[model samples]
Target: MNSNVKVIEEKILSNNWYVLKKITFDYRNQSGEWQTQAREAYDRGNGAVILLYNADNQTVVLTEQFRMPTYINGNETGMLIEACAGLLDKDNPEACIRRETEEETGYRIGEVQKVFEAYMSPGSVTEILYFFVAEYSKSMKINEGGGAEHEQENIEVLEIPFKRALEMIETGEIKDGKTIMLLQYAQIKGLL
Candidate 1:
């Protein structure tokens, strides 16, 4: 254990879908001197993204939703095109992802294959996102997708041809960082 790296205190700042905490820690810098730093860390709960693929139609399921953060920042429409994703509340990554997939797209994924795990915006946030892809078939039916009502999510699920999804990326329509990374990884691995 690194003795210099110690968390002195932690304070909760927010407790919405994503929780924010202020942390104070001491660490040894390259100069070999102990330094104290304070950071506002976002505990976004373990997040997960799913790439739902329809094997028969060669398509992928995606969602479009209004993101206030993006809207406030500069997106003209304030809408984002992304894979089905959500924050894990006490559940493991796989289970959380599977549940999110069903709630967001009405797709019950079978045999999820883990693709990647990464930190989203590590500069100040402590969100670890797990990415997975599951083979979907036309036989899969949509019961009723729109996210959980308790969370006030108004999601519109869309199915796009695999090739068109790549086009959306090239056209700069898919702007979410994690979604881009996962799609690129899938394409590179010839899984798209």
Candidate 2:
């Protein structure tokens, strides 16, 4: 919509799992001269993440799983400890988080507070992530949550002290962006 830029053309680079497109565009420079630029963007849809905490227990629920991308990018083990998250296939953000929490962490939570939303990576990825926080207790654990079986998800649930979760960040053990953000949010806001 800006007069400073115009998309020249877009080509589908790949559509195997999600859509990746090569975008060529005409951009007006600082001097008002048009220049051609191209960039590749990956569209994997949007997702939601949540950090579940229990004030009484001073604990937070987290999940661990193998991440192929992390493995290839200098992560020795490729295993990442992250907050429960999932792509919002067709549900609203709240519904998506609720569903993902139960599926990934085995907690049927009620009343989640939307903390914020952010783009985890914006340079070449088209995904805006929604974040949430909720109070949880042992009474809510309904099953051994390890993600959905049909989706081939093999998530490991972990419940640890809130203070320990923060230390994991310093130890470089919890490197996931969304998870870290949520944990920091809890700490700054004294949610625990």
Candidate 3:
């Protein structure tokens, strides 16, 4: 909580899926003058993302899904390749990521290394995304994971060579920010 700001009013703008609120506040500027401002913030809750890598195989596991926002914004097919991720509704970051990984990738990984957390779209969405990396082998696969049918998620799992995955970035094939960040992290740390 910054002492430099005070909430004046808050109103719900929309309550369809998550929550959208319009908040008016009094902000103390650098010059020590108080100014009134208003902003709309969407609270979709925090989430967790993970990159599963196979050091022995020099491969990485990723997911492909259709994103409506991308479709409306100019993405030709609206299908995006990204690291496995899910919202932390009531579970902790680790548990949420574990469940998401199994549901999306068919990998029942045992150990995971947390990398970092970040707010992906701070300007409008209130979501802190926790990031992680884990080692995986063929033996870890338990089922043919697509996604939860109840949630209408149609996710596709992808396993690509670490080097080829990097090339996809240059070719504009993998455009998701979290996926790009995780891939770069792996490269920097020499995970593969």
Candidate 4:
């Protein structure tokens, strides 16, 4: 609690699986004025995303799944191609991404490089996502991963050429933010 800021109140808007809250606060502006503001924050918890690639094969592993939020918001099919990712329930970011890689893409990843962390939607979401990159080989595939059956995740695995995956970004196929950032990072770092 800085002296310049004070929390006025927090009201819960929803508490089903996660929480959504309306927060009211007052801030002492630099102009020597106090200002009150209200903002809604959705707390779905933090998550980790990893881009699995094969330098030898010049390819990357990706997954496609239906997203309800995207669908409701005018993504006609609601299907998005993205890197392997999942919520960080109790595990650390690296452990979470490794587990998600195997669960969603069927590749047991090792030697992952943590690239960066980002607030995906800073204005209204409290999710700080950890981004990573890892190398994968065919031998790492232990099972045909479609995510946890109990969670009803119908994910499709894709092994796309690195160059083609980049092209998808221009053609509007790979629209997921985390995936795009990781892909662009790969391009910038010459990982592929």
What TM-score should be assigned to candidate 2?
0.98
**Which residue runs of candidate 2 sit more than 4 Å off their true CA positions?**
none
Task: State the local distance difference test value for candidate 1.
Answer: 0.86
Where does the lowest 10-residue lDDT sum fall in candidate 3?
142-151
* Candidate 2 residue-wise lDDT, 135-191, digit = tens: 999999999999999999999999989999999999999999999999999999999
Best by lDDT: 3
Report the lDDT tens digits of candidate 1 across residue range 3-47: 769999999989986689999999898888999999998876678
Taking all chains together, each candidate's TM-score versus the true structure is 0.92, 0.98, 0.99, 0.98
The global C-alpha lDDT for each of the candidates, from Candidate 1 onward, is 0.86, 0.96, 0.96, 0.95
lDDT of candidate 4 over 10-114, digit per residue (tens): 999999989999999999999989999999999999999999999999999999999999999989999999999999998999999988888899999779999
> Which sections of candidate 1 miss by over 4 Å?
none
TM-score ranking, high to low: 3, 2, 4, 1
Could you tell me which 10 consecutive residues in candidate 2 have the lowest summed lDDT?
97-106
Task: Name the candidate, 2 or 4, with the larger lDDT value.
Answer: 2
Residue-level lDDT for 146 in candidate 1 = 83
Alpha-carbon deviation at 71 in model 3, angstroms: 0.4
Structure candidate 4, residue pairs in collision:
none
